[model samples]
Target: MSQMRLSLDQLTGTNRRAADILLGNDRGGYTVPSAKLYPFQWNWDSALVALGFSVFDSDRAWQEVESLLSAQWDNGMVPHIIFWKEEKSYFPGPEQWGTTDIAKTPPTSGITQPPVAATVIERLLAEDIDAHRDRAAKLLPKLDRWHQWFLDARDPDGRGVVAIMHPWESGRDNLPDWDRPLSFIDTTGVGTYHRRDTDIVNKDERPKNDDYDHYMALVRFGRDCNWNTDHIARNCPFWVAEPGMNAILRRAERDLINMATLLGQDDIAARATARLARLDAGFEQLWSETVGGYVTLDLRRDEHATGLTSGSWLAMFAGPVEPARATKMAATLTYWLSQVKHGVPSFDPNHELFDSIRYWRGPVWAMINWMIATGLIEHGETDLADRIRRDTQALIDQSDFREYFCPVTGRGGGGTDFSWTASMSLYWAA
Candidate 1:
């Protein structure tokens, strides 16, 4: 292990506590994103969780990835949530999805989340090439298919940036970026359904009642189309080409290019490189000089989103950007860091919709901090990156591995003992 990894392991109390929380959340092959709020293996959560496991248990890390892949759709789309076994704790379970009839695997959500698998795979391979090579090779084709699915199904107009049909797919369900597009979506026709999430976390911290109505409306819309990608791409009410998903997809595409070249798959490497270039070019459309960073675009409305959000910061993480633009984005991040006690609040502190205690509205998610910090480092802002890493660790240390932290008070909120929080703590601490 490197000196840094050794020092991280030596932080006895914090490291020990983080490891325990991670293992406690583990359910055989996959780890739940959290205990009560999110009980299933979530797509991006598992990928990030695996990166945490790679720090110590390489085998378990690979198992997390393999388990997620086991549910991959034949169409190459990997659903966002996998209902590994029946559980009553969560809402909109497999029954609501009505996808089993058409799906290739067991019950899973039809929509997909951010593609972080390629980034995680690259991390695992970097750790132990000899041990992970075979597994990485096995994962290549599946990851390729998943990437291809996004390009083919989500990006209808051949724009490198793809539209996320559901708020859930953006992974920032209630972020202000989607509000305008979501406003256009008519949810009155969708009937009531009991939400299990509020029971686990504060209703105020979660998406509001109206938000849920619109969310279910989108779900019902997709279900009625039998989760057919083509139809949903062409007709879904809430089609948004947001920055977060596009940034992550491009980052993943670039990583896949590296992995493919290592495996001597020239064809895959070529395709990934081409896709990455297109994504970088397409991101130009998302840039908002007024916001001083990339903002979500409501493709359906053909208008820029209302507020600056943490999701906008993800453009730094996706890959390289022009140096001048990156410098300005860094300056924008510095301004945001100064506005809140915690760095990288999910929503801009100055925004009208900012809610420090709410989940995505303004809380500082550890995972988000890690991504943005890492990206900042890659973009030559090591000082900012280090500050973010320290802030994230301090939050977990002070608040104890909660799902999200309040930006103003730094108090942990939402689900306690969250898997990704613990995982990211381990990662950033290292």
Candidate 2:
């Protein structure tokens, strides 16, 4: 470990305070992303939270992963929002997302977010195999089912690349990449409903009103389909193949295969290996030479988004790309770092739709930085990786653990005392 990592392990007043923030956000068995902006156990947020817990409390870390998977759907698809309890602090609650048609699981959003559970599980196990083995046994089969669900539902065409039926599924609720496909969605059926996100975070920091309209429009569509996976996949108006979701899923699938191998589950290992081959080939369809990074394909329209965002940078992190492709991506990342004080901006600053404060459009998220940094390190770009870690640490220290940061100004934006931001800070410090 580096000197900074040694210092982090020593536990200063700052570390104690960061831990307090995490504990403060802990609702009970699980932690919410935050108190006001997000009041439920979110899929991806819980995975990241597990990493932070592993830094100090390994048992709590494993429990966090266990709690997240406790709500897994029978089909293996882990719903995005697991409404552990009712809270009116956020919009599109359990009532809004009627998942009763899907299964008798906990109240959850019909659509799933990026699957990072396997990746988190692999990391925790790396810290202690003997301690996490039994838990890993329980999780591996469910994870295999989840991966199977993605293939069966999202990649029906056998393109190897899965499609996101809703923007929220991408975990980037309103990225410019979806603007084109979202426009085609009919919000006329969306009844009178209030948005609770704007109530807590700045309106400028959230998705635009039009984006929300389409978001709700898709929600209504899912509900109309009765949350039937086959029905929704066949008829959904919006279908975006996001690089971030693809990358995360790719990494998770790879990790799950490794875990499955250790557990003597050869069936899952074989299936995951086959899926990896398909994903490797399908990536060609999403490659955008003009953008200098992999871009998303609006599968519904059979069109590709030209805009480059943080999601595109995630391709390298997902897995190895062609050396030439990785070299170009490295150049692209270096170019963006030159444009802003921050190493990665959510969207390219040169793009007309880029917004410094608005969520997903153009903000540097700590979680994203941590992921991109890890990718950079794996690709042997240690300088950029170190820069990202340093920048993330400095920004969090200056901003007091806000949700995201302004890439150009290094100022915090969105909800404060955020769980993932705190989680990333602790990881970066270590």
Candidate 3:
């Protein structure tokens, strides 16, 4: 295994270089990883990327989110990605949504992407200096309203768990987990749409066509309707639960509750408490006791199903899985490790549909490794946690952040220099 300190030094160097632009006086807030792909504002990517910015300039870290937050709609929803002042051709720019009810004028979404802003805010506040703290102090009030919108608009049933109106809201963009549910939609009339992903990246490196079809269909549906929620909710695809995403929301709700409590927003704090209860129950419905892991639900499927994704470990983030269930989960993960050449395959390797080179089919991702390791440590599987940590570190040390790894050989597969993978090194080290 590579020395932790040496690995840390390598990580810190990348963090510092990225921070120079993120926190530097010379640049605004843009420091995205994909020059070709992003070339514009990405809502959730920049939110998490800013956490690394905090280690350098807490002020800049706060601004990164502020740039995103500034675009919040009157309904308090933060859109997934925002095009810049001049970059309109960024495929599916707000211009394409002129038919939808959302501000085709500015294209601000009346829905949220992910709830990471609050978590990032909470972390920054806990570690920031007076200047950093002051920025967060100012941001706290604004972020609170956005967080409240999540409870208000997305919660739908007043359950603490928030549902995503579109799969893009999860920001995973075409995970097989969403496919079966997304397939029920009729996309016959959306007209022809072009995909840019398969252009620069190989088709094998991208999501399945069915996934692409559903995604573009949904986006077109939203764009055609001007992003009207009541209209879309009635006719479009809305996912009731995604364990990995809802797991993050469960945690974000907790963070917002703490922030609200600190800011004297008792009503909001109480609402968050009640929401947590619902999400906790929501998780139980999604768990499979016999399989010993959590699976995603297709609110569209009308029945609970087995997904066997690395996402099963999301239960760990929600906190202790029931003891019997956690043990089963532990075994299920172990079973997957035994099947794949990589320590953990993205999907159960034995499954017929597993595809290591394709996005989210079956490949080891550094971030997923980070989450599962945390899950492992949480479930009295510390030995396995250490094993994951060592393996992940070894992978990064050899060549940082390849999109996916061969399921059976640990051969680096798919894209390179992915932002989240680099950040995984820091978060896992911490």
Q: Quick one: best lDDT, which candidate?
A: 1
Model 3, span 152-208: residue lDDT tens: 666565544566767778765656677667767776766666666566567877776
Off by over 4 Å in 1: 1-11
User: How high a TM-score does candidate 1 get?
Assistant: 0.97
Which of 1 and 2 is the better model by TM-score?
Answer: 1
Per-residue CA lDDT of model 2 for 125-171, tens digit only, reads: 87668777888988888888888899889998898799999999999
Alpha-carbon shift of residue 227 in model 3 (angstroms): 1.9
Instruction: Give Cα-based local distance difference scores for all models.
Output: 0.86, 0.83, 0.63
Looking at model 1, report the run of 10 residues with the lowest lDDT sum: 1-10
The TM-score values for the models, in the order shown, are: 0.97, 0.96, 0.84
> What are the clashing pairs of model 2?
none
RMSD of candidates 1 onward, in order: 1.8, 2.0, 3.9
Clashing pairs in 3: 100-225, 100-226, 101-226, 102-226, 160-275, 341-408
Residue-wise C-alpha lDDT for candidate 1, range 1-430, written one tens digit per residue = 1113433355467766777788899999999988888889999999999877766777888999999988899899998999988899999999888889766466899899999999999888877677778989999888989998988999868877888999999899899877778888888888878999988787888889999999999999999999988899889988989898999999999899999998788888988887778888888889877767788988877788767788788888998878998888888788888988887799989989899988899999988888898798898899999888888888887899998999889999889888888888777743
